[model samples]
Target chain A: MHLTFYTIWPCALFNINRMQSISSSSYAVHFNQRAYDALNGHLSEKSYSKIFIVVDENTHEHCLAPFMGRIQGTYDFEIIELESGEENKNIDTCTQVWNVLSELDGDRKSLMINLGGGVITDLGGFVASTFKRGIDFINVPTTLLSMVDASVGGKTGVDLGPLKNQIGVINQPEMVLIVTDFLKTLEERQLQSGFAEMLKHGLIQNAGYWEELKEVSHFKLMDDLIYESVQIKNKVVLEDPTEQDLRKILNYGHTLGHAIESYFLENVEKKALLHGEAIAVGMVLEGYLSKDLVGLPEAQLADIKNTFLGRYPKVDFTEDDIKAILALLKFDKKNSHGNINFVLLKSIGDPVIDIQVPDELYKKAFAYYAEN
Target chain B: MHLTFYTIWPCALFNINRMQSISSSSYAVHFNQRAYDALNGHLSEKSYSKIFIVVDENTHEHCLAPFMGRIQGTYDFEIIELESGEENKNIDTCTQVWNVLSELDGDRKSLMINLGGGVITDLGGFVASTFKRGIDFINVPTTLLSMVDASVGGKTGVDLGPLKNQIGVINQPEMVLIVTDFLKTLEERQLQSGFAEMLKHGLIQNAGYWEELKEVSHFKLMDDLIYESVQIKNKVVLEDPTEQDLRKILNYGHTLGHAIESYFLENVEKKALLHGEAIAVGMVLEGYLSKDLVGLPEAQLADIKNTFLGRYPKVDFTEDDIKAILALLKFDKKNSHGNINFVLLKSIGDPVIDIQVPDELYKKAFAYYAEN
Candidate 1:
């Protein structure tokens, strides 16, 4: 199903024609302008029983019409609008979608398009995976974070209460269409949240991409680089579809990031951290953990902190808060047994997964904030 | 995996020295006397992590120890007892088993041995199947009906509210051990309930078996014929696993039986019809439906009706009540679209599936019951 997506780019911007590819098995991560075009073209060719585009209430009001218009298909499509927010990402909402699908007499042949941010994609992907055992779905991520992060991997689930992704299965989507144009409609906070993951992609895999991104402060200039980030994620995910080994590296900032996200979610008055924003902080803190655990070069650790601190200077947490966050990390779903395994950078461009840090190192990592 | 189970029976009564082909999926369905020998064999050869014997409350108190003592093994197996009755067959109870399994760190290499009647086998099979996607379970059916019906087919599920087997998936057991010795512990009603299914199995598939069962009034007389009934059920199940086509023959009495079961479960003060009892009555009423739908011979219908009528007599249901019962059949999970489908007999031994009878015929089937 080939599709043509139009992007509103500046006249003088060097448009590299952003393309992304996602793989579940050990398939090479293919990324270029042609790959994205090919994927879109492939989807447009199939005649489905129904075109069901699931979105959150926010995205339904914001992004659905243009998405329907952009697709070349002449088929009629239906929208299942879900409530927007992390709190609503759960099995209850999945029941609602199941009801809608059942009421509509959706058969094995129907297509479910998740067109929104992470919640829509995550929940929609989960619903499709479990509906009648399983079915096909495509992800059209609108948020910058979802475009670069959620779109590539098939990690789809709703939170089980405060326990994130406790009840879920591993199922990959058939295709993921990441259009950076959707980023234009995002809130600045959401934009920054997504950009953090993109920076992590550069930090963990490609030094050249990191150097290039450092030179450009124009947020729009990062749009073309989303494909590069997706490529790195796809490579990691494809190698370990079931998260047995290599995929743990992608959890770089997520260990502490999830704890922070869960903490703020419970303390409703506190500022909510978008996943990417929390993870950006997590990446910095985890970078310090890497320095302590793996003897990462001190100079490289300073560079990682300075780059994130320069962009996100307002993030402030006391050592006590870090202690609390560290406690939350212990309950991370990824952790097996009692070990608090951290995925840390071997260097600026390499991530080594399953690195265990001692309790004292966690204190030292938090102490770095005081020294700074 | 090899598991040895024993029943108190003379060695001369059991047979099966001729069939000795061993494959990876080797499961021995020990019937009656042969079940006694199974208990006397070495269990480690059965390849099981932990031997978990599932039984209901009633079975636990009355027969658990005797059954356990008969099944000699090097290691004393843990008895995971459950509350008796169809009411306890649900996700909550399954959750109890899951919690136990999780606490025990039961892996994919574990085995679950279901010991009781239909409830233990069905619910236990479902718990094992879904615990870690799937697991192996052995069904040791103590009741006559489950021996021939439930144990043969891999249909495992708990009821959804008043609905029978509503939330379930199809998964076959690794082996079925039919130990009729346990039948001595059953109440008269439970024994009769189980006999009803065995009669229906004979009526639908084996006319000779049906004739043979006619001479057997007590569990002791039918003990000799238990193997014959189970083999018929196993053959039919092997031919059609999912009940998509010919598997419906097994549902010969189920159409009206299910409606009757559901009706009593909701309105009547007395206990609901046991599955076999309900299906037994269903066979007689559906014999009338089959007369028109499949041109079932009058002599054959009369034979079916006379056999069941002689055994069960008639349960009271007003003309209005029969109409209501027929209406409830419309919501049977087996029905596709809006039609009420049935497995009607073409003759005493030939069964047809997916047969849709007209509303007038449905009314006639029940009206015939009232008139007779």
Candidate 2:
């Protein structure tokens, strides 16, 4: 594999306060009280045919009333709830929601607000984009995974069979509302799933962010971290809207990350790891490869290993599991012309893309992850 | 509704040769020999992981062998075929194709060639667009309806139940290959269905073209007409990619035309008319409303009525059928905030969009359609 250097996106594109909203190409990501205000103003400004809020059972019970209470206008909104799980995030669910929207008289001018986690935002964003050849939608992300990741990058899709996010589109929402209160609704496991992505934001684009993120004792204490993670993500997305080059860096750990997540999800006996948990394992395996290929320092490599292992315990990978996981790597979206490409970090805050790692090194990388 | 004048897309954007290709936002429409040459050049140029050619049953039997014989490359291509007709143009069919793509190792770098009528191009385009957040695709339209209308415009979508094209996105294919020879495979009724769009194009934009179109006794002899019709369609689509304002004029007869089409499609007892056959009736119905609503002259209205009636025999619509057709208009993608909008003509070749005709006039319009 040959080394190709890429320009890292600037951390501070401009000086702004901690709570300020970040804007991408077509939409803005508003935070907290400002998010609700922006939504209300937008609602009042445009004459929508209808307003539909998409939620999972958890969000419908928890996030919906609070989200609706914040609305300042006298608008009627229909709540379409789906069953919450990664399994439910597929084309079949999208069909059900689409049928509901059509049955409820949802038209071209209808506004859809996605009020759950990544599944809600990704699935709901896709539903709005395709229904009637596109409709306006807002993402009121209610989980850390969605806010830090799916909130900025217009990556709306669902899993096709065992593959992760195999069907979807990159169409932006009208706006993204990041409410930290919704983050509190998540359990430690789900919250940590999002936290893993924030830590990735630091490792790929900002060393200071990685340093600050690694120091956080509690996952709940993340208002500032969410802002910083989104800034890093938004900066990367703005530079590459359609994910040509610079955007692949955002998929740094996601190369093996998605494959690992898919393997765990598909295996009948294995307990399904949360999105971040699977990615957490991916970072370690890829980090081991980065040390040899990208000259990642020994001390920093150790730091990376310890930082994640502290929260994410190592899972038992049998020989069959490892073989299956390796087989799934070829199905990754990043792959082209039958070669597995890696987005490796030259160092913290420095990323190199489209680097091929040979098939021979797979076992060694897994050995490094399994080592004391 | 007040009269608003829109700048009609010019016939002579630039004086290119008769058989020359026409360019849209990102892709071009290549004719006959030029179409085959472009496809061969495209196939040899890109290193695609897999080449998927989407076809319907009819195209698989007739269009595929001839289409494949033109290709100069030795590249392996996979054929994914679906059931023909508008009934198959829905999310369920899209799910089947998407599954087929995943099952076979179709990836981001794969190239899709749509080789069928409008349903194939529309559904295949959506499948390619959403498969792994979109892959590159080309269109080789195999019907007169598809060649003249769906060739230039990047309107890729599937029908939602009874509503026509109520689901999908405005995504462009890599290139479109328009081969007039394939029109021979279409039945007389199907050819007339496409001819309806050609008539509408001339009515909405060019009276000189309309006069020429009326002179052609056979739909079989339409090479220059197809080129000119695509030129008109391409000019309008280029000006407005997302159908915001100027593009609305293209929907001249489609407002009531789609409603009539859907009404006939949903009722199993009623014979399902080809798209253009229903639109021919719509032009008569809407032309009557245009006389009173948009100052359409008596002579021009008679010209339109006689031109369409000469081709399409009148169908007896029970009073109930007329009521059901009118009720179906509310579900149209063009409607906004519960207002039924129409694209009415001030005269031949000049149309005004977003005009509302009162309920009192719909019955009168139907009566005018029933006139001797």
Candidate 3:
């Protein structure tokens, strides 16, 4: 899974080479120079009527120039730049993109290239999937979070109000292009935000991967680690594309994580947390529950708590916050008929799905996180 | 294809019998009492968190009471009604319904019952399909247009501004239930509006069916024609679900028909035409093109024109209206790279797809429809 050498594509303007190719569901994630080559080849092969490059302000400024510099193609490209930030990740943004595509003569044969973080890929993929019923699209994920997780899964959507990804469809992109170089532009906080998911990947599926992550103290953005995270997610996604049975393992942290994310996002008084930040808190709390309910070893529970707490700053959940977050649990996507279901751990790397935690335990889970 | 006898459903509260079932791709089109039986079984079998009955104003008043009176099985239901008409089939309306469903705690396991015409079925289907990624939904089409055409095909969408079906997805419902009794409540205009699609069915695929439709002087709502029409459409849909090649033939009159429909719907001075009314004008015009360009026999072309005009009142297309209508043609769903493609007839029951009509013939097609 390592990029040992570089080979230039014949028609490429820049010295691009293959990174790594990982298969997921119906599509593949092409990394580094391979991604650029894939895009270039895609541009040449598909007689796309039009190609739309979707970018938010951040990517439009930081990542787009480098992207354009590296990619080579002879097709008319439309730049559809959206406003940045999580707040803009809603249906209104989707409507704007849809209107832009329609106004610019984007027919069914047109192709959309989503070139930003999760918000852009999610919203752009959704817009492409629904525009005139649907149109072909590709993803060029530029952030650490998107590269590792969102890029692999065909989970495209927009937030419904403060609810994350409430309205969307699971339509695969042609291929996901991951250019890790773009991650250099991310702030340290953003990098940390994304690394949380990598940690999550280890906790749920592979003890060796968790130990490997534990060995590294600096939270380095290693491409191998990123690739491993993607492979883990892609495996789960492939097994259950529609999030049935086995795929429920992917929601190990997401059940409570999403509610915490939504709670912080909506409350005017609190600061909004990045997805990984909230999910980290969720993993810590859920790990505590896992030990008590699902037979996750006490030592492993302590290890999970310490590992997340070491890298990610622990959120101080007030009594009020805990109550609201619990109420929000019913809105978790995993729930069926309002029963809040959790994916807990039997032990390190061994996950159990559909474990119900009593309401009384939710308070204890929070208290465990709050303690030193 | 006629209902010869009635057989009672075992769990049915009343003497509801199997009508006719025509299978589409993954689902079936159940007609009459069979529709009720299908709904009964679906409700009893699946543990849906909630049931949502989507209706427009017309169906809410005239259709809902009877629907409620007939449907069996104990399940809590929510009634979500929208304003009636094509104008209400947009994202704003989708947002409203989504908000209502979200507010009422509609989860992933919820079942959406679209109990109206194309507006309800199309809009409701799109909503259900995209809600929480996707959800189970059933369509109980109350209009003839819906029963014959929209029901069999999994084409779900809403118009974008004046553009017909500009924003939508191609998603199949759990099943499509057609109760012909609902058509009795429709105005003559509405029923006539639906019959145009049936005429399309006869003209595009079955010459014998075309002759049969021609034999009748009045546009009578017949269940046999509805079933046959649905079966014809179902066959095409099954052959090409995504409208790649064979399905493009479904767009026979729709290229110009949709533009004409959009033009009339958007214009301030002109009264908005029903979908079928505008499509009827399109059929007459496109049929003339077919005779000249695609070698549709002159007698059959004349027959097609007379058949449509006899039932549907002729829409007077002014030169200005024709020009505007032609401009609107580029936005047709069938177009690729701004190329206005038409599905012209080689003969009655034989449609040639993706045929580009010359610009000069525009006025002539309009004149052919206007003259006696």
Candidate 4:
């Protein structure tokens, strides 16, 4: 029996307009112009003992200069820069950040501003949350993927070896400020990678949203699109902060996506796929599985394959590659009691979670993806 | 100006008794025979896909064999052992444990039983708390220090360099089982070391209990003393789980004790001090400071010094050693805005938090300790 659970969070605390910020519990997510004011207001109000801005090499150059110019507060803050990439997102990186915070005498009252992509946000959030048993942290997501997905969830962690997010905690940041201005600095491939998650938000929750997103041929800094995606994810997260049941739906494509991502990352022969690109392939394969196992419409499955394959280049997974990916599935965070669980769509925007897909069907799913 | 805030946690959820288990928000601390039953019952009730018992070298050899014989469940469990010492309680150890858990396919439903002293409990708690954004964990504290201190607080972390608990989270375990039977295997020094924290519980909060603890000449398996110490700490932690105010009293000697411990551990010439032994010296020095800074009575200060010095041999610190220990004070976790904050007793059991000490008074306190 499939354990499907979804609760469309009332969005009771959110303000939809660009002028207003979305508040949840003790924090808020500020967008575009509102983000600038939120950061200014937060710094102006709280007398933090010290301030730290954590960034990656890329964000230090591309985002920090503009952010520093626009930010209203004149407080002294140290810039902690890490090497940019998913490869550096590990305990060692976290140790370096923690040591920096400690050596710099960051106490309970200090504030940490995570100022980069998912790697920076994730690693910074984990360090801040665990440092001195937690300190105040705010996220200024520089990458599109981080702004819409990583920043919204409060999921802070570093990857362990080839395993993705194997070590982390689900602690919310004090605030998340998303400014589309950083998008200009992103490479085309990076921009496309983030767009995949936005596509996911639409596919898993709102059919109309999927249709609207599909019409946009080029990626741009659209406040409305970012806001909507954040709203969808925030709503789900707030309803189930611990990801006990309802939140599992968010991992619809991630089950296979994460394994595939890890496999490519570990194998020297395979080119490293960006998170969104890997998950894009995962969506197509899972879409086929959904049609076979959950009676999703075959036409909708074809549409999903066509849409994702058109945007993300198809990866040629040899049988050995597929076997390695399958081997990595046991490490999926969602799995319990040694059972591999999947979240599949019965129809567009309608998901069924905890469905056990047979190995034979998994082989067929790959076969279908290969043909596409 | 001292920022003193104490909210006597309503004690709304606690049941004080020798026979009954003490329940917290998400966990319980089971004592003596009750611990065995609690473990058996927990394992029987929850069908964990895999069971892992994490221990240091000491516990694996001394405690694991007997623990295995007594455990009622028939489920197979893996033994993940680490080296026995504070030096091993770092991110690297956590990485090792995480890798083992990952290699063993420890999913969200797997259960990890931390069976050892403070180092094991702290490191294991941190690893379990972060692995897969948390999994089910039960701490089986073998040492007296862990039973009364680490087991009560939801503080889980590993040390960064020489700084104590520099990186960690305040996430509680599923339960903690305290079996004094393991104490028989402990060395006399280790036992005496743990006794210091129990002494601290009384000195910080209950003068009457302090008088009673002062009367003991030998360290034995006194379940009642253990229970009371646990009760005192649990009360303080429950009131201020985040250590924002009232809970600071628990760190009465810890500020100096941690620095001294870290100092000794880092210097090759200085012998490693057990957590409690360092804190014992810390209590004596702070007790002198309490007399000088907070009007703790001279006679009570003498009694505190006499009682601890009689039990723990004095470690002669050269002028350089004093300076090094004092310099390490800046790294204390309680410091804020670069100022060292100490918890001093106005009288035995009556403590004040966030009291800044002047340099002259600090030097005088060290001179007093040296002379004593």
Best prediction by TM-score: 3
Compare candidates 1 and 4 on DockQ and give the better one: 4
lDDT scores of the candidates, listed in order:
0.70, 0.85, 0.84, 0.85
Candidate 4 residues A77-121, lDDT tens each? 778888888999998888778888877778988999999999989
CAPRI-style docking class of model 4 based on DockQ: medium
Worst 10-residue lDDT window, candidate 1 chain B: B17-26
lDDT of 3 by residue, A1-372 (tens): 001112232343544543469987777898887887777787778898887889988998898777776756456777888888888999888887777777788899999989999999999999999999999999998888888878877888888876788899999999998878888889888888888888888988999999998887553547788888998999888888888888888787888899999999999899988898999989988998998898888899899888888877778788899899888777766678877888999987889888888889989988988888
Chain A TM-score for each candidate, in the given order? 0.87, 0.94, 0.94, 0.94
Who is ahead in lDDT, 2 or 3? 2
How high is each candidate's TM-score?
0.72, 0.93, 0.95, 0.94
Task: Spell out the clash pairs found in candidate 2.
Answer: none
lDDT of 3 at A159: 82
**Candidate 3, residues B1-372: lDDT per residue as tens digits?**
001112222242544544568887788888778887787787888889888889877898899878877766567677887888998899988888887777777898999999999999999999998988989999999998888878977889888888878889999999988888888898889988888898898889998998887776554548777888888999999999998999988888888888998998899899999989988988988999998898999988888888888888888877898889988887776779878888999998888888888899989888888888
Model 2 lDDT at residue A354: 92
Instruction: Tell me the tens digit of each residue's lDDT in model 4 across B1-372.
Output: 001122211112122336578877578888767777777788889898878888877887899777766676467577788888999999888888899888878888888889999999999999999999999899999988898889888999988898889888998898988888789999889889989998899899999999999888777747889889888888898888888899999998888889889999999988898998899989988998999888999999988888888998787778788899888899888888888989999999999998988887877877787783
**Candidate with more favorable, higher DockQ: 3 or 4:** 3
User: In order, what is each prediction's RMSD in angstroms?
Assistant: 7.8, 8.9, 5.2, 8.5
Task: Name model 3 segments beyond 4 Å from true.
Answer: A1-19, A219-221, B1-19, B218-221
What candidate 4 gets wrong by more than 4 Å, as runs, is: A1-19, B1-18
How would you encode candidate 1's per-residue C-alpha lDDT over B165-192 as one tens digit per residue? 6545566677677766677877777877
In Å, residue B327's CA in model 3 sits off its true spot by 1.9
